[model samples]
Target chain A: MGRRILFITTDQQRFDALGCNGGTVARTPVIDSLARDGINYTRAHPQNVVCMPSRSTMVTGQHVATHGVWMNGVALPEDAPSIALTLRQAGYRTALVGKAHFEPLLDPFLRFAENRMGRDGTHSEMFTMPDGSVVPHRGFDHMEFAGHGAAGNLHYVGWLRSEHPEVMGKFVPNLDGDLEVTTEPGGDTMAPQVRTTNDVPRGWYHTEWVADRTIAWLDSMGQDDDWFCWMSFPDPHHPWDPPQSELHRVDWRDLDLPAGYIADHEEREKVLASKPAHWMGWYDGSFVSNYEAPLKWVPATLQPDQVREINAMVHVKNELIDEAVGRVLASLRARGWDDDVDIVFTTDHGEMQGDFGLLFKGPYHVDSLMRLPLIWRPAKSAGIAPATVTAPVGHVSLAATFASIAGLPRPDYTEAPALPVNDDDARERGFERVLTEWDSVLFGKEVGVRTIFRDNWTCSAMLPGTLHDGTEGELYDHANDPLQRVNRWDDPSVRSLRDDMLADMWDHLPSVVSPRRTCDAPV
Target chain B: MAYIRRDIHIARTPAEVWGFLGEPARLHEWFPISGCRVEGTKRWIDLPTGITFEEDIHLVDNHQRRFVYSIVNNMLIKDHFGILDVVDDGHGHSIVTYSTQCTPNVLALVTAGAAGQGLAKAKRILEGGN
Candidate 1:
């Protein structure tokens, strides 16, 4: 019998947030246990730093260039080939439960048109064809959506209204609201930390709802049935709200400054000046500001204490995620299917998490933002030893890996290499370098950035005139400065290394002859 | 949320118009899906994108020349009900009025676009435009 696959993904979780990955703040024992029992890839990177592109890559096994979801606001083509479709064709039951940010929440198609017609409602559900057979979204036979906000999330909100009406009215809008305000140590102005403690009971939390539905689905499946489930969690991403019960599970007073945060502005300015114009704009509040803006630039006036408080909330969010994961695992064990299932735990992209004085992510593809924590636990019968793989891998390899685990022929359209799951010495034989791309129009300027990570050296370059009048780049020796504090692109010592990496990145550039236009269909 | 209703007069008979509009299986020819299946009063449609929608057919009256259906258990829409009425204009022509009500009423455009395209195609095929 094919092993049941339980794939879990978290949004905006950093690589170092797990205890198993040497994180000091977050308490992620359930996730840490997965690393202890499974194979952990320490240096896995996302093909793109943003949500939509990275998720599209994960499902389609195609790079952002091929999938055409290079940035937000673009939807993945309905007919695009997906891993879920491949697995279903091979007779495996597939389902996706949780956040699927495949399309922008505020798509123009969903907007009201002058003709009094528009596609209302979020397009996260399965599209019905004329025939009797239901087309699985991307290829999942069943989908349960629980998006970011209550207003946009139809399924979760419906449940909340029926099950916890009072809490829904009181807490849904304020999920991201600041519950506490305090004056910075010396500053006269109060810097409000965006954090909330949910009054809704633990059982009604979205995380628990996801676990409950997923477990109910698993229970309905026969013991002999083969299945592939993508249980995505929307938390630890933003709106930094954890249930009051889970928030108390972790003491915020125990948290400290993130590893790479440079509290000194003078030192930060020196580091920022050495990089591209967009990077400087992010620190100085010129490129983008405010959370609602499409371009996600950090505020320059953000205090260090505020950063610490946000990180503390992030840790609490991680704790809640861990508990949810634990409940799902326990359900699997109760059904006596734990031994027959293979689990993959990872995140879409990393959060800045106070790295280099930045809180969130944008054009910057620093290690803290690009690197991901990927752990794979095979079925007990596979007998794969728990070991750390230091080789470079990216989200592009997921579809191919899922196909391999299902014992099915890999689809012909996938561009990613099949992950080395069975090979015990895979780390020693992994890719020498991995590539990630970014293409978006930010601040009325089109920006394209690409980074090539080779061992301990990271190099990033921006397209000419995208950010400023001239082309710009950044190089960092992670071996000495893992926090990416200094840019050494012009340093004589690493010029040759930088040149080689840049050449490789240029070769990997996707050739664009004609970009695919958005679908103009009325629906 | 928005609302839209369109009435079109076609140079065809009501029976000829209902022949295409009443049959769920012919949805793909004019609508977006590839094919549709109807069991009792419930119809399920298959779109080109591989997703499916379950719609309940409320009224399929040949005498009244009206067809009513509502989408149920759909992710993108709620409380969606659609009505298609075909009336003999007493001059050997048929007038079809398509109306829809749904939450986030902006969906009126989707219904309008589909109705506009479907009715145009039905008129053409009935009047030998295809």
Candidate 2:
């Protein structure tokens, strides 16, 4: 029998958002404890910065190019090889208990049906078998779809209707829409806006609901049956809305301004000018014409106080998630499965958290949005000692790592290596460099960016445009400037190093373009 | 509350337009569902995602060239009803109108997009003789 695998992911969490990871303001003791007991990969980076592609890579062990979910609107193919399917084949009962952004919430087919049907029932039946068991979509035997908003959240919305109808009434109209309510606009293009606070009660919050449902699922599992569960939480992501009860967990007065950020416009302009033109345009509101206007949350201006308040709300959301994780962990222990379960804790992608004068993520591949916290805690009997690894690993390796941990044969389609769990010299095992890609498909921009993180240098270049425009690239010497305030792509001294990194990135590109598929395809 | 209305000019008589739109089986052809199963006035629409939804027919008036239906027992919507009307344009052409009323105003955009697409498909098939 294999150990039960508990794969937990939070949305839009930063690498340094945990207290154990040196987050000064975040109160994440539960997640911090996971790092204390597990192997923490300090330099883990996601293959893509957005939600869909990054999550797709985590499950399929394929890059964005191979998976073809270059942006959020695209869906991961149901036939794609997944870790959940591989584990199910190994006799493990697989279940996903939270947000699976594999499919677009507003897909034309789903929207049309919902409009015609007048009711959005638990769409889980779509993924169910004739015997009433779930027909695994990408390998998970059961799915509890609690998406970000009530508009498309099947499970969470059902719970809300049954439990807290009043709260549902207030949130449903604006469900899944932009969470940020502009209370006070930034006077200029560099200031942040003061946003509204979250109003849901602590008990009815999605974070608590996800945890409660996950614990219930675990309790239902047989004593001898091994299970694989992905407990995904949708919070600490956006809307920056933390429940009123959880808001006091972190005080806004105690918060500090983001590192690598100063209020000086000239200094910020100098930093933004050194990178891609679209980034600066996003910051200054010039790029709104090029992309979907409503989806753009990046404000042209932000005040220091607004940024601090947003950070405070983010910390509160993090603490709430930590509390939820603690409950799930307690449930596992109560079932006497603590010693027989392997736990993997990570996020879909990193949040800027006001880093580098930026609040949300965009075309830029800065470390704040690219780097993620990767922690693995093997069962006590696995004989893997706890230690922090500094090697550069990509989220693309997670599917392979899950297979290796479950004692299954490696899937043939994956290009990622199994995570180095027991190896003391994991960094020396050729896990030195990671390639990150950004296809401007979502924003409808003409530029595509690819970045390589090797050694202490991060090199990024815009495809097609970088060849003609000298300024369309960025090179950061992270060793000297950890905050990445300086761009050295044009620096005469590191030209050779940049070229080598670019060649490595080109070498890792997919040889053939993989076609995208709908999630409803027959297996 | 959200309201969505889509009107298309089809090169067919009002009776011909209502004949195709009123029949549940013909409705499935122009609607986005891959297939549908009908039990009296209730239809179980099968989507590409494999999920099926139940739509109850509230009224079907052939003389008025109007059909009315409502989606019942749905979680995401409240007081949701749809109406499809066909009127003669006096030029041997018919003007087809599809309208919906639902709560949670954001769904209006979704309903509008889907209705526009469905109507466009119906116009193409009717005019192109497909």
Point to the candidate with the largest lDDT.
Answer: 2
Tell me the tens digit of each residue's lDDT in model 2 across B24-122.
756668887678887888977776656676789878898998888887776665567889888998898999988887654434445555666678788
Give the lDDT of residue A335 in candidate 1: 85
Question: Candidate 2: misplaced stretches above 4 Å?
Answer: A111-134, A169-197, A289-298, A422-424, A442-444, A465-471, A512-523, B1-27, B30-130
Query: Candidate 1 on A290-392: residue-level lDDT in tens?
Result: 1222232245777777676677768877877888999999999988888888999999898876777776677787887888989998888777677787777
lDDT of 2 by residue, A179-279 (tens): 21222332112223323344677888889989998998898899989999999998777656556666667777677787856568778888887776776
Residue pair clashes in candidate 2: A119-B74, A189-A300, A189-A301, A190-A301, A190-A302, A191-A301, A191-A302, A191-A303, A192-A302, A192-A303
Give TM-scores of the second chain, every candidate. 0.90, 0.91
lDDT of 1 by residue, B1-130 (tens): 3355667788888888878777766776776455788898889987543557789998888889888898889876766888889888999789988887765443454455556656777777778876
- Badly placed stretches (over 4 Å) of model 1 are A107-134, A169-193, A289-298, A422-430, A516-523, B1-130
Q: What is the lDDT of candidate 1?
A: 0.71
